[model samples]
Target: AGSPTEATALVCLDLPSSQVEVVARSSSVAVEPEYLSIPEPIVFPTGGGKEVAYAFFYPPKNRDFVAPAGEKPPLLVKSHGGPTGATAAVLNLGIQYWTSRGIAVLDVNYRGSSGYGRAYREALKGRWGLVDVEDCIAGAQFLAAQGKVDGERLLIRGGSAGGYTTLAALTFHTVFKAGASYYGVSDLEALAQETHKFESHYLDSLIGPYPERRDLYRERSPIHHLEGLNCPVIFFQGLEDAIVPPNQAERMVAALQAKGIPVAYVPFAGEQHGFRQAANLKRALEAELYFYAQILGFPLAELIEPVPIANWPPPR
Candidate 1:
């Protein structure tokens, strides 16, 4: 019938603000340790030139969250595995486990990481320890300046290559109170000299060809600087991890401990590069959470099993 009368034409509608209602789901949702945070991504300036990328896991507000006009919550910034990896807005129960307890989590994607397209991802090529570590520190600063986090209480953690970032950040920056590196690389020279085939050539672009940039490897490795470290640190390494052998964590812990910096090294047997088993992952996460609470003095609601880390900072 007459082309179905064209069904419809343009229509104008004006809605009144008086009629509009806004409700913050989180504003009403009770903060819980398992899923109370929102994942957000933020970009920050790089010290040299390129931009750094990061994903934030914001905790549900106190609803009555009154900041006393100047106070801020503590922050836990994380880095993902694979120096080539990116932190998605994925629902990592571990992240929420912290947020629900009044912590903010930042899962960072440093230079040489993936998902920011190719150009940003390759920025760390031939400069692994420098750009990657700097970017992470920058992200923390950015969040602090936003009045979102207590800068002095900054914490950084990472797994695999991410662990490498955590170690570098703690070694290079003074902002972090504590840090955890999960099966991360500590000595580039050793890694390039003895790692399996898959990663043998990977560092060629990450740091430089082995033996050629040997100085650079030693210069950036965190294990060498444990003498100067004064912060609390913990390491989680899978005993069977072929990528970053347990020896890496062992050396780091021993060195840091010798220097009197609080350190805990847990090398789980039969586990691989990353702890995939539920129990191992669970213990790793719980241990890290409790370690931070004890070190940083932030009251964590969840009961973290006692994994004694000797000489931890005076508890809060």
Candidate 2:
């Protein structure tokens, strides 16, 4: 129930003796305790002052390194997979991967995310692309405005439903400088019509009854609004993904390539909707970091195989 940096304890209250007994007070993790980044809960305004969203900000931390004087760290804004799922202050090594490497992380719990109450969850109904994207953008902007992160280096990433939000934000807004999508939905219409029955029914509330409100789907779809997305992006997809097939990432990558935008696509064989194998997970994370380093013109501390980017080093 506690984060990696914090410990959870179980205690007993003895009525007869009027004394407290401590049963448990510690937890363990693979990494050393001092190396883990701590999460700070943050609430910020979004929707042009119409609404508020929550997030957990983890600043860059390393036991042996210090950042350059007066240099702000780059930020990676994470949108959790389930549009319905909420992010907690849990010890996530995936998040620590960035923080441990001199990058700040903002794990956003946007408007539609659960655990905030009925009205908050209902906020996404009929407004999936709008409210969620707005909240994410706002969270990044809030941190930038507070002199916490480099606004020019704001990046976003997500998987599945969260990946949809990443694409929407990049396509419809100009806040982020780069992004990475893992099996994201580029076209909402395609997803509504092609996905399984459960997801199809779910979209009824998320984007409106499919056939009847088809116009909304097209308007919100990132594939249809590619012109707005001018920055670099990298995509990771499982070749055998069924929920969000590989075609989703392929189509977007192709479009970006044609537009001369910086893009990279890394597809894994035998992987599915979410990466389960240990090796694939590690490779995906390393590839994403490599992509960011190349785009941002920084040298990575570790040697990682470079991801080939289409339309890189645009003509000066």
Candidate 3:
């Protein structure tokens, strides 16, 4: 099952483990690098049926057929942007850095995403904020059930559409201990009302048609629901980002600050939606890791180029 286009429903099968030997499921089309082996699809029981989530769990190497003795690894629930994009085990030097350090990363291909065919991709249609948020929550739940991730040290991070899910997960749910967003959508209504040509009409598929679904655009927006967000968040955005203007980043920063949440907003001057300059990218990565380390009480790995938080301790 696959989606040729973006923001469509995903179509998958329910293969009961009891009949695994008899049932056959279609394979995914994502290409894997020569050095890596992709993990299998994981299913979590949703309302009535199972909601299939695509993920890659890289664990530490076993020692001489003996279980390693260490605390459960910190889990990072990664939500990819595009809301239409699927989280594949793509080759990345960063993912390696974390896994090598014994961190567990769960990249979620949530509802309303592509690569699952048309039907499953459409699972988020007209249910934008609520459905996608639920998927991330479920992904975390799946990790905790495995008993390998520290439930108390969970983090959710994403970019673009992925950022929107992160904001929603932090605001609408309490599963994550902290979160980070890169040029994510803070206001859905503003995006629908003030987007560029390529995506001006894109909301028609993810949520609903313009003018008709205007209410949804407002209600699903995280910016409008800042009052409900109480967790620590660190956001990065390019100063000149046209896709998600600096104002969106500023507003969220302001709201979180006013609510007394430990929030850090770093906008790279002259940078666009995606940070490309090496210095800026490096700063963004280090800053994000620093934020999570500070909030989660994780071991500090030589805090490089740290961005000091004015109000260090979060209000209890």
Candidate 4:
């Protein structure tokens, strides 16, 4: 796989003929390719002395532009959905989207994520919120200890199951200064009752059988623990989503607003479990970038109207 500094080039190797065929060159918005940062694979120790894996992408590289002297770039830790899904090392424009704009990204493969053996994947079973949350926190600490990212500017984001982990991290821990959740689960009990058949019993393995472990669900659910969350948060939800449902995001937004916390909720009509419309996708991405810039005190690379945030405090 190509590193973050280099655009991914595709080539076909012919062993019998001892020949190499070039397929295509990777493209980026940056005029110069060298300005893009490459991804570096790293493993760090988490709870139980166990190590978790992640791909760290550094800030954008530009010959003419230099960051403020003695300034460290902020880090955005991404959690993949599925809770069972694993982040691949493949070249992704999404990762580049942030790095090219000066944000560092850490794509985590927390315990219970796939790609590793069954044992590692099963580690998340019956410990979804705790295991995933710890691994993400560990990854941030690992990067901060290396002095590669700003320790105080940590952020977390994810979709679906990963979104759940994002909310869990923001609510249960204070590691992240801000967070974004794309159709994430706020109430585990609601998810257990409302999710479709395919995943209706999925939590049975992740958090234990529902009704049987009702208390556990309530304890881990972020909606039930809004008092513990303090940082600013932005949520993107599909109004037609059946898996997580719109009410989940709505409830969380309402609670945060009631508490006078800085919160922004973006809901799209006619969208399903995930956004499919091009316009919606673009809007969501832009809104997230704008939201982060506003919260973190950074200038956005692109011109976008600001998304309204409720209960935001004036600059101190």
Candidate 5:
């Protein structure tokens, strides 16, 4: 079946007449066409200005709501998992959740991401934090320069390796105003030593052999450089996660608490790695949106349960 718009549908082929027939749809609820944002493939300069990175930019769209004139929508830079993973032009309701609510989404395929060829994927070797972080920053800046998003409201989020990129960006650079991490790595050295056997040596090529290049691990780790991350951040973590253990999120939350940065932590008890339970997934999404609304000063169209942000508004 052909999908001209973003949606989940069912169809069948009529081989005898060489025609297509609609069988059904995945969802019972009908989403108006005007509410779905189309993905636009974008290529823009990397931080060095030498090479370009790829991404799918989804601008905000909703028939019932419109931003005030001259107001640029906030941009959410999404770092996909696997660090080596690449994003695609598929229908993703998670992305739509942000766009339909007036937030633009930039799904980045930074250096080392797959689907771009071998050399591109290898570019992340020994340069995970540096290369990936720069590409994400570049994508947001590119959108701002193009007048597509508000420069002041640039935000980021990622899970697993992407989560590492989000932490690195907020820690090492001043570009993103705030960020969210879904079980992201904060300490590279810890990750190299603590991760499961399948991925135990994963960082060997990404960074270097453990202990042999321990210096690089410490240097690139966001946990070690928490002093640099002053902005607000919300963390969603599955308490049972083994890939990126709960410690990763807890450590950062603890540091943010001590430093008085506005931070929120939401942990799911029975879930592991990526959320599997339907209710937990929905809760996390709504919590992140609520956190953003409070931090960005944008009013939500509907009520959502509030997530507690520590150190917000500064006590008099």
Candidate 6:
């Protein structure tokens, strides 16, 4: 069942009262193993002298293509959604999509992220933007120090809560040169005032009681700190997103454009918090890849039609 290329298995566990049989499998599709980079676990130091965990995936092996000599591949630091959610070491085509095209990915499981026990998950309490942002930055620095990725060409991206971290990193730090926010939160205060019932009180734990500590919210919200954001960014939003709403992305796009930063925005009419439709998903992935290639000055292996970017300088 366990093979080098792919594996499938069925096992039975005998309990005191009954036997349970489960089927586990990997896709049989003929995706070349060389086109996929195995996930490597990493632990690095972050703020407050604490450490965080992440999984790093290097550029894939492609016989037909090679990067320019002496050029380290650009790194894309991915922040998984949920701030509570964690990135898994699964065979994800989405991660593979970037790796196969010569990009390195660091899937961060930042502090306050789940799966590291209740205490770590609670580490984000009253420090949503700070802990997550510092952990992500630390992961990128660790990789760069190891000479595994190009330090100058670092990019950060995420959706939902992860999107919030992406925006925070780009706004508050100078480490990332570019970013992509997929339906990310730009205004924590706005979110607290307008989010759905389920998350209406969620920030009370993530930040503090609303209105009581609203100043902290304003300080952490990326929209309010736009003066510090100078890098290129592309955003993808679902018009029907109720949790974060369209305005989250719209306002950020507007602000970046006003500052003459390179920016692009894509909105899907019928989508929600996360993209569901296959077509929209495909479009989002291709657009992000194209956006990064344009900003990082790299050639994409695929022939994706260019997505227009505002303030993008003409090719020299």
Top lDDT hit: 5
- For 73-100, candidate 3 gives per-residue lDDT tens digits of 7878778878777766544545544554
Worst lDDT window (10 residues) for model 6?
1-10
Candidate 1's TM-score reads 0.82
lDDT score, candidate 6, position 271: 96
Instruction: Tell me each candidate's TM-score.
Output: 0.82, 0.92, 0.82, 0.89, 0.92, 0.90
- In TM-score terms, candidate 3 sits at 0.82
How accurate locally is residue 4 in candidate 4, as Cα lDDT from 0 to 100? 44
Give the runs in model 1 whose Cα sits over 4 Å from its true position: 1-35, 48-52, 60-71, 313-316
Task: List runs of model 4 lying over 4 Å from the truth.
Answer: 1-15, 18-32, 48-50, 62-64
Clash pairs (backbone) in predicted model 1: none
User: Which residue window of length 10 is worst by lDDT in model 3?
Assistant: 1-10
Model 6 stretches astray by more than 4 angstroms? 1-30, 48-50, 314-316
Candidate 5: the clashing residue pairs are: none
Over the stretch 97-188, how does candidate 4's per-residue lDDT look in tens digits? 77767788999988888878988888898999998999999999888998989999999999998899999999999999999999999899
Q: Evaluate residue 202 in candidate 3 and report its C-alpha lDDT on the 0 to 100 scale.
A: 83
What local lDDT does model 5 show for residue 192?
Answer: 87
lDDT by residue (tens digit), candidate 5, 57-134: 999998888899999999999999998888887678888899999999999999999998888999998899999999
Q: How close is candidate 2 to the true structure, as a TM-score?
A: 0.92
lDDT (10s digit) by residue, model 1, range 22-93: 322212223343334556668777765455565554643444333356568788888877778766664455
Whole-model lDDT, model 3: 0.74
Output the better candidate (2/4) by TM-score: 2
Candidate 1 lDDT for residue 110: 77
lDDT of each: 0.75, 0.90, 0.74, 0.85, 0.90, 0.86
In model 3, state the lDDT of residue 112.
72
Clashes of 5: 0
Native-to-model Cα distance after best TM-score fit, residue 56 in candidate 5, in Å: 0.7
